[model samples]
Target: MKTWILPALGTLVCWGFWAFIPKLTTRYISPMSAMVYESMGAMVIGAIVLAVLHFRPDVSGKGIFLALATGMLGMAGGLCFLFAVRSGKVSVVAMFTSLSPLITIALGYLLLNETITLKEGLGILTAFIAIYLFSAS
Candidate 1:
């Protein structure tokens, strides 16, 4: 098997647990409050990762802009997700958001000039339909 499987599964399990936590927190506390604590914890973990890397990662202008954009976009998604779970069914919200790779796929095709095979296109199409049907209820 590929070497990434273990870490990939770890991510899957971690995110599975992550999607559950907000639902639990929103039961007692506000989603915004939960987001406050969650962002703090994430920053601490991010700091640790930086420390472990000895802060050796790229810091060029292009790199900085890309990294900044990534952090901003991810945090925005997290905030939105917290609110989404608070208002909607967790299963529906989670599954719907999980199909976000569709955005990346479309962007890749448009901006990155990436090729999409007919079969992969069909899969993406199916995912879009699934997300729509899942959310429409």
Candidate 2:
């Protein structure tokens, strides 16, 4: 078995739980309130990682800046996701939001000069069709 496959599968399981759990939280409180509690949970994990690393890691100015920016963008998107889960069916909303990989593919192609093969192009087209279907009332 490939090393990456294990971690990738772990990501799939973890993110699946992450998506469903927020739906449960938003049922009881405002999305913003749920996000606050979510941040606390995140902090607990962050603190454990920090302690494991002895509170230090290799650092660079550009890396630090980009990491912070990523956190900000992720938190903003997460809050929007909470709002979406609160208002929409969790299954549909989760499927729609999962198309975020399309954005990553586009950005990688444009900014990182990544190649998209014919198969990938077909997949992208299928994603567009899925988006259309998901958007339908």
Whose lDDT is greatest here?
Answer: 2
Alpha-carbon lDDT of model 1: 0.89
Per-candidate Cα RMSD to the true structure, in Å, reads: 1.7, 1.2
Model 1: residues >4 Å from true position, as ranges? none
- Where does the lowest 10-residue lDDT sum fall in candidate 2? 128-137
In model 2, which residue pairs have backbone atoms overlapping below 3 Å? none
Candidate 2, which segments miss by more than 4 Å at Cα?
A: none
lDDT of candidate 1 over 1-137, digit per residue (tens):
99999999999999998887888889998977887898899999989999999988766998899989998898888889999999889999899889988889889999999999999989988988988888888
Q: Say which candidate scores most in TM-score.
A: 2
